[model samples]
Target: MGEGVTVSGDIAASSDIRIDMWSKLGSRVEVGGNAYLGEFVTIDGKLLVEGDLDVGKEVKIRGGFEAKGWIVVRNPVPVIIFLFLYIREMMRLGKGEEIEKAVEELFEDSEDSQDFEGKEPSENIMIIPAGAKISPEVIEVAGEADIGSNCLLIGNIRAQTVETGKNLTLKGSVYSEGKIIIGESSTVHGNLFSKGQVHIGRNSRIFGGIKADSVLMHENARVDGTIKAPSGVSFLREAAEKQILVEVNALGKGIVSKARELPKGVLQDDLIKAPDVAEIVSLIKSSAKAKNGFVPGRKRKTARTQALERTRRFTGARTYRKEKSGD
Candidate 1:
């Protein structure tokens, strides 16, 4: 017989149930053997099976249950399931309960589920919800990405390009081969490794180091670690070297103007007279040394004698006769 189909009741399929579209078993979906579903299938309620559930494409299970056999879901289903468990864990934490032990078991189950099933992931971008902890894997984003708040990822995100918005945080490293534009109010805890230009907006905080070909930091952005870029580094603030150069240019202009204001002929005359004044002072010093400090006293006496001789030459005997007549 053909594969069995059930809508609102229990499905007791001895062999297999091949579904092309949605199969909604309202209460409990029980299969004695195996179950196969095609693309765009939805099993709304609980699914209990003695065998495996092989979904060739997307499958949504609104209510959780067990599958005895290997559960296989293609590309986007795995991504969706990952998002669901992530949100559930966060809700548990918000209720003010101890979630450490429960979270550890959840992680182990997620790892086991991922290991057992393999899916061909789509090239489209995947958004991870808050409070989700993903294991280490290389997720390629061919399109734009938005990671919700409180998400924790252990693996690196490689993208053609990436833009992170506000309140979003990334735990592991981000490697963008293309341009990376981080929006304002976002925070990244791990290292950001990029080959292309990285633009960080205002109020964003990056705790780890950043490696990129070019980097642009907007006003008010804070980067705690070092940044290594080979092309060039640009800062919003004025550089010290440029300020020094401006000061030096102003000083040079001042010096040039002062030099131009002085008379060239006066400067030349002073240069020429300096040597003569130096020679005269040197000669006087030498003569004083030779006379054993008596040259200054002898020179003063000679100057006085010369002044008396000049006075005699000018007034002569007439001054002497006038002095005798008491006139």
Candidate 2:
């Protein structure tokens, strides 16, 4: 219970078995009733619990975990890795030849499709529906793509333009010649490279760098890595940085040159005053955020409702109805 012990075979307990720290069970651990695991307990085989299983952190289950009731996993890497391997194996079993043949048949009927004699089929689009599971392989689409939500794609996607729905998880890179729109709560574990603009929704997480002509990001969006954009966007960031430099000079009591000021071509509106260093920093951050299409003070719901009301008022039911007396 308190000390370390190494057992070579299976251990079956009718009641509860408590395996403490530094204890190693080389084989299967079967509890006819309930089990409690402390820290650093290693079970090399399957863990079967007929009843409740209370496991502490750092408990490693090398084989499988089974419980008739509720089970909680503290770490998900093992599960994710296991599932990925299993899916890859299932996708590889006797499916490659069938898929290849199907693709060949589809291409053979290309003469009937769109009647293109010589030119490459550049207008075909691929749609990945919601709640779909796809392996990470090479995906090439010449036209626009609409990828739905709750999908797991483990491959690179090369398309002309790509639009994704919410909660999409992609484990590979995405390259688009045109605009790329990513939905909310989605994750791209690899780099996103686009020849055009990239728009990301709110609460989305990007684990890799984003390279595009321009990037539009919503509030609360996180880019874990770098962002590369065109000269204009870079100019804005540089301007913000220059403001910090100006602030630092001001703090040093140095003469700020008129040439240090931003050109009127950069900012059209009247310059706002930042009272202090903190305010200057905030201003810089706000400017950077605004460059990503996230407006600081605007409420999305209020704006949407106002727009709907205005539209309703502008397009009243009388317009559609025949002008009774005027006719």
Candidate 3:
């Protein structure tokens, strides 16, 4: 055969096999089927056969070539078939309708026939529904995407910037390459992870952990778990107040413990202070002035006297000063 010639069967030569140009083979070119090509041999043609083709150097082929018994080709058909099948299966599972349809058509007949007798028709076919919901394509960014209010998302979302508006709810996790913001009246049940900043608006509720470079909570916002950020953390006034209240409990315990640790003399010093009745009356007169825009007159004084008598029965304060002059 010529230098670029292609053969379908075996080619046996007594001398060395050499070709300056490309040489192709449609089928296996068996050299005695037992002894293959010598070392440093090259076959440019694609080899396809049920038998084996052994060679020393590289063998180039086009399309798919198969050697079932013992394949020594540079490119094997079985590997390509396996890879193709793997990709096909992946596409099918990815819900690609075109790929799924092609695969189904490849395995089943295209013609449709009515059921004969009482036998059920074959069910190898599948129909894609018209209203099938598909997940949204994820948009990834290195910066950020500010989500406005009242936005509807049907698919996965990923961004570097995520700013949610009031009354916004996402169906999926919010993965931010940078920062995230949940505005007022928003609710997020999914996880939120950001590399930069995370701000939860007032009246927002987050059921998942919040991680970012920095975290800020507005007034009345509620978080159920840990908030971790590298740079800074800001708490609302209400949250700070609650934290102060929590610390108050511990402070109360410390106060009781300190009192117990004190010596008898220190305890007696605390109990020796006498109640000042004149100062108490002056305080009441000031309070009455502030409430009634002036000091209490005769009628107001009579009301206060009655109130004091009622409180004295429950309280230990029994001393009373009637009028400015001590009585």
Among these predicted structures, which one has the highest TM-score?
1
Superposed by TM-score, candidate 1 places the C-alpha of residue 128 at a distance from the truth, in angstroms, of 8.4
Candidate 2 clash pair list = 136-154, 136-155
The whole-model C-alpha lDDT of candidate 2 against the native structure comes to 0.69
Return the TM-score for candidate 1, rounded to 2 decimals.
0.34
TM-score between model 3 and native: 0.31
Candidate 2 off by > 4 Å? 1-135, 231-327
Q: Estimate TM-scores for all models.
A: 0.34, 0.32, 0.31
- Report lDDT (CA) for all predictions: 0.60, 0.69, 0.55
179-216 per-residue lDDT for model 1 (tens digits): 78777677778778878888887778888888999888
Model 2 has a clash total of 2
Tens digits of per-residue lDDT, candidate 3, 203-319, equal 888877887888888868988777888898897665221111111232233112333344444544443232331311332354543655456553445778879888876564334
Segments of candidate 1 deviating more than 4 angstroms: 1-138, 146-154, 236-327
**Ranking according to lDDT, highest score first:** 2, 1, 3
